[model samples]
Target: MKLLHTADWHIGRRLHGFDLTDEQGNAFEQIEAIAKKEQVDGIIIAGDLYDRRLPAESSVAMVNQMLQRLNLTDHFPVYAISGNHDSATRLATGTPWFKQTDLFLHTALSQAFKPVELADTQIFLCPYFEPFDAQQYFDDDSLQHLDQAFARVVDEMKKAFDPSKKHLLAAHFFAAGSSTTDSETNLTVGGLAAVPTDLLADFDYVALGHLHGKNALHMRQARYSGSPVKFSLSEAAQEKGVWIVDTDQTPVKLTFKTLTPIHDVKLLTDSFDHLIHSTDDPAIDHDDYFGITLTDTQPIPNVMARLREVFPKIVTLSRQDGFSTQVRYQGESGQQIRQKAPMTLLKDFYEQVAKEPLTPQQEKWAKTTLKQASEGGQPS
Candidate 1:
């Protein structure tokens, strides 16, 4: 059967603190259009259906609308699961009703190792499971790693797994060969939980998720479709898309279909004043969202206002050195700050700013300047 494989929609997710509801809405429309145009038999979302455990009202509405449209034709089925970032109970609340309409959602650990059979194919559903959650499933306490837990889970799945039919698995976790963005939150700590692609040899194909980047584990049988929308600055350069796989015919064909979001987000480097003043540039005039960096030593007051005046959708700005935390004040209050500082507070502030105490010579100069200020003399 032809199946559209996708994951990590992260619907209702905010990028750079800018709400991406409009962008994500457009993405959902595009996904529906692609599904219809391709005439796929089913769509499989590996995991991470919603961006949060408690989704906003608009997010819930958007999900409902998208799912309804996807199943409107009633000819194609949509299979979904929950990831580490998702709340299983919330996502699985209406699964019983969705199943009546050919939309299968398995978001509960209680339903682990269940196989949904469709047209002679057994599609195994295994959502992401933490060590503590999967503890009871393991025979020994030493089965602490994800590899060990999944190994045991797969064995259980195999018991119910129909080996005679073409087997396909859906899961969301960090695979050994996959890479993650710095912004991606870790599901588990240490190295106790990495599910290798080798764990899926028994299944004909494995659809994976969690890593935002696309492509298989450097091989073909297993693949991750990545997020359909960019979710972070690290993902600023990625091309969001979905994967389509069909095995009904001979030798399955896998296709990656690109889904472009309405609002394009880019990390743009511009001269401070140029960014502040350049309103005529095409990139600055459009509805695109931009995270700008002012490559200057000092930023003027009302910097955000000036930027937004030129680029209406400019959401974030930072001086390249802004990430640098050293603050050297030279105003009239600088001397008072130097003289009236409590050592504890001073040390805490310095630690927060990633700095050490001033050198002996510098400290002497500061004290002298403070003493002069105390005597009604200007600080040197």
Candidate 2:
């Protein structure tokens, strides 16, 4: 009754237009290795198998290969569901045929509420569904909100509940009190969107997903395993991995297992010059994708291009300079402005109006242009 609980695979996801298939493939390798080492009986991917509704052909191939390795080659039963990011109809394709080999995939509400029984354990798979769709599927017109729909589903499961066996709920929904990251799609319908954790308290163990932060929500035996890889800059520091649950224990023994990635997301802050001049560290993987913040007061020309020479995998660049501060307008006499250098006057004016001082390179160019104007020459 041991199971490897993982979620938010987000396969074929891109970071700053860079393809992450190789990184995701590396993650899958880690998953396979962990499954072997942990010797878990089965696997449960709560939801979000793909990054989008329709994934690329390569992504499809990648998923096919990984599933085959787990279910066919390694002979482990895999139970998966479709998250909000997945296309239910698309994911459900060939699911009937796949189940012939112990690979069970659930998508829409019509398929939910049915328990997949495994050796004295009953696994209830609850896929993501819109409240309206769920209402129609259950033929319950009173289901006006997401919570109400889920409550009805849970009530149905209770009707057929067997007290002697272990009941596990694999769900793809955000529970109240879960920490959310920017990468997740916000269901901003107020109270209609989130479901209370107490509603799912009946199950022995609840394998939940949707929110990207690992340990996002806390309940007795319910937790989100989080995305296997960092999906956004907000998730840069999160420890990405899977959760292992042993049903053999009276209360399931849950263990968090970490997975290593090929190109991990990293955030670095320093002056652009230092980052460009810093030598590559052999011990550290400099090739990791980075979100860099330049602390220089003056902007550097061709900063991205120059930094790429040293840090080729920079994905995001931001300027954290004092020049970005809003300038207060202290009235100065026009006579006093005329006494100052044109470049200095221009820089002050620009900073006041634009809320950002001119870069050193721009100041130099402005000085040259003013000198050309004073000399009666064309300014470039």
Candidate 3:
């Protein structure tokens, strides 16, 4: 079976505050063209179909129009799952109605084991799940970690696995050894929220989402067909695209086909003098998105307005001074701050900000207020 693997569409996503609807719409058009050109058997979108839970009506319409054209009109089957960003309940609301069409929208834990068979390949959809949810679902209190939860789910899936047919797992997860960028929300706090890659060894192809790079996992068979467009300044250099999989080969054949963005994400650095002079450069596309790093030590007035003349979609502007060259007074300063009492620090901060020490009466009031606050608003 020939499949076009893509994920993390994040339809309503914006860069800074600028809307990416036009860019995203163009990308979808390209995707449709690619699908038609390739004439693939089906399309698999792993997760993060939208950027938010309650997407704007415009966003809803945009996605609906795109899906309608692809699944209903074009007559190509599309299988998708909800990511961390999506509200699963909302995505699966039209489950019954969607069933009549070529679109398969899987959301809940109950949907994981069922395979959507296409030709010789059986695609298993495993949407994002919290550890607590898995713990409750499996009736196992020991499912405290992500790996444990995945192990349990995959184990259950194995029992019903058809060894005769080629199996593919479509999942949204932070797999071990995958490289991540700033745009992705942390899947877990403090503790690592990653599942072992070997856990997915049973499948011929493991199509994944969550981390936002096509080559995030660095594994051949198990791959992430990253976010189609750049979502953050950190992802400016990332070559955005989808993956084409040919499951007929011994080791399934994989190809990375690049998708051109309407507004390319880029970072440009130059002094005020150089930028103003290069306003009419034909080589530069003013409409493309940008993050400008100004080399000037002093702030220039109307810099953004002037730059917008040459680069209209500048999202962020920062100075090199914001980044420190070395650790300055780290241990001693930290130790001093820790050694000082809370009340003393507060008094010192007040003095610094006020430019005067508190009067005796004011000091007494401050102490009393601090004591009351420490005692949870009770007199101490």
Candidate No. with top TM-score: 2
Task: Give the alpha carbon lDDT tens digit for every residue of 284-351 in model 2.
Answer: 46788899998876545587888888888888988776543222333566687689887777887787
Question: Which stretches of model 3 miss by more than 4 angstroms?
Answer: 188-191, 321-380
Q: How many residue pairs clash in each candidate?
A: 1, 0, 0
lDDT sort, best first: 2, 3, 1
Ranking by TM-score: 2, 3, 1
| lDDT (Cα atoms) of all candidates against the true structure | 0.76, 0.84, 0.84
Over 4 Å off in model 2, which ranges?
A: 188-190, 280-284, 324-380
TM-score, each model?
A: 0.79, 0.87, 0.82
Candidate 3 lDDT, 304-361, residue by residue in tens: 8887877778889876553221222243476788899887887766664455798899
Write down the worst ten-residue block by lDDT for model 2.
322-331
Which digits, one per residue and each the tens of the lDDT, describe model 1 over residues 1-380? 87888888888798767888888888877877788888888889888878888988888888877777887654569888898778888887778988888888887654667788876688877777776667765546866778887788788788886756788888888877666675467663345567877887787778888888785365566888888888877777878888888876444578889997777778888787777666677645346778788776543657787677667777677887653334444333656766756544455455545445766685677668767876899875
